[model samples]
Target: MAGPTPDELRSVVDRFPTPPDAEAFGRADELLDGTYSAIAESWYPELRRLATAYAEGDVLRESVLEHVEAVPSFRISEGATPLTRRREALATAAETLDSVAEVSAWYDDLRTLLADSPDSRSLLERLLHDFGYAAAHVLFLGASSPEQVVRRLRWAYRTVGVRIDSVSSEAGTERTTFTCPYRDVAAGRCGKRWVCHEKLDRVDDGYVTYLRERGIDYQRPRGCAESERCHSSVARDGPSQWWPKTPPSAVEREP
Candidate 1:
């Protein structure tokens, strides 16, 4: 596949899907931003207490606090752009962190601290929903070419921890099918893998629909959260031939 040109990349980036509650989520983040410092002040000490209890020392505890404290406000940064425009926010947040390991540790401690708070749990769930949208952003977007689009789709799924166990193509057709393991959520080690089947289906629908809308035929025949496993195929002409086999009807044709 060819590398995506700047314009082509922009075209794909333009169509990224926004979470259903994006506006509400953005407002919540904005409100939280105003109180984040106070929240951190109130909570960091408690986190430190937990750290001590868990045998984590001041050095490591302080490191976590510093990282969280320095995080940029999590509001939807691109107000001029559609709410659908979302990848930059996640990518920016990712850049703010030192490493993937740091991200994992930060969340692990936060979850531990908030384990007993129902209100906090609800807020965390919203954050996670948005997180999934960001992780799967590229799957709903366009690409420089059909081949590049497929490449982007595969890469996006992998980023969300969806392993592509196998891939094969049918002869004379640009159709390619990828089989995935049965795990429903692909949140990697981020600890937010509790996403529901509904959300997973939405992601799969968006991916397949985006391909179809852009003239690349495709279908998602199975969803890991709802079926035996996740499976999706793309073709050049259309998805009709890719549908599951069905027995011929007993009734005669109108020939």
Candidate 2:
């Protein structure tokens, strides 16, 4: 597939709530952009090295790239209520880490299987496990807070098997209907701390008006490039005029 268009990427990102502060968003954007760049730049070389060791050659490299390119974008607006905001942030973080972890696990397995000889299998297996752990750690470190990262990573791994068929399918309903342990309704860490079980509704005129009152800018472009620009702007200067009026907060708080 031709890599995800900017629009597709934005659609993924637009699903999550924005950070409460411009700096948070900026840092998150930087981390995301850097992660994307690192994968784009190093994945091929790393794949090539691993492929050579396993004798799979470029085929493995190509496969990995195809998988990475297939990842859907995810984003959420910060217009949600505080409870919703917390839940969305946790969910978004967990999902993002899960994607990276899954990819890492797959690569590790491939690497182990490709070992040059039977003698290499043990070493390769260890290496692969380390690699997978490292990949997850990289994501965790890039997150806004270490505690949040750890919590979400644990949640993501535990809930890996659950599935949501489609966003459009779930858009009109409340999150309580979902039957996963990770669902925010179970009075667990996520339920008590995040709002994962909140309902989602269409952005009606009233909601839009609310956003306007808050000074959030909502005129998002439907195209890919423009969408990237929109994210870039928010990453740099916070949201435009259509989101809630809460000003961006500082990055470091004792909390």
Candidate 3:
């Protein structure tokens, strides 16, 4: 008989018992480190799936596996926790969704995972940052009508207990305001209060970039992360037209 081929080897490895015990988790850690054969790359997906099957449920196996695989090798910090790494991976996956249906499906998985893992505040912030950009691109970039856009955005956030207060347009101007779920949802996750504020700021930047790309003017003044209530406004006119309408701030007035 021929020596075990890669597929045969993989089959045998897959058959290895996957129990929810310390030893299995240790095996996962070893597998993640490429401790087995030289064909570690090929085994990664299967290992992730097995790991998920052992930890979470079978339904989440694929989603969790995809989430774990999305993290490029360079992105995983040397000392980061596995949970942190997985969350970042999920952010990359969630942000790359190309359609409304895809985005909705991702949000469903993410919402449930976040609720079950409350200590994942930092991860939640990362997801929201990417999600804001994705949402803006999908809704504001001709994917849906303004009404549908607002409704979809509201629905996504509501799944996580966050409310999108307003999304409206008037005389070629659009403005939106919403409460920051991170404030309540991620209260004890971080060591400092300012860290939470920083997270909000970053997410707002993603939103602002989305509007800026489409020649829309975003009118949120100062840092939004500092405020419990976040808000953003956009004018339909291009950047050139929007720039002249607003009064100059003290920074701009300085000699």
Better of 1 and 2 by TM-score: 1
- lDDT (CA) per prediction: 0.38, 0.30, 0.41
Task: Encode model 1's per-residue lDDT on 1-255: one tens digit a residue.
Answer: 111233432333233222224344344334334323333445444544434432422122222333333333333323233222233333332333223223334444443432222243344444544454454455445463556666776776687566666666565233333444333345453112133332343445445544555666555433332234455555564322100010011011212
Residue 207 displacement (Å), model 3: 3.3
lDDT of 3 by residue, 1-255 (tens): 111233433343344322224443344333334222212344345544544443432322223323333322322222222234433433333233222123233333432432222233466665766776876776555623334444444554576565677677886555577775565435455322233343554454456567666555555422232355655455643322110011122113323
Which 10 consecutive residues of model 3 have the lowest summed lDDT? 241-250
Off by over 4 Å in 3: 1-152, 166-169, 184-196, 218-228, 240-255
Determine the backbone clash count of candidate 2. Answer: 22
lDDT of 1 at 141: 51
Reference-based lDDT, residue 187, model 1 = 45
| TM-score leader | 3
List TM-scores for all candidates, in order.
Answer: 0.31, 0.19, 0.32
Report the poorest 10 consecutive residues by lDDT, candidate 1: 242-251
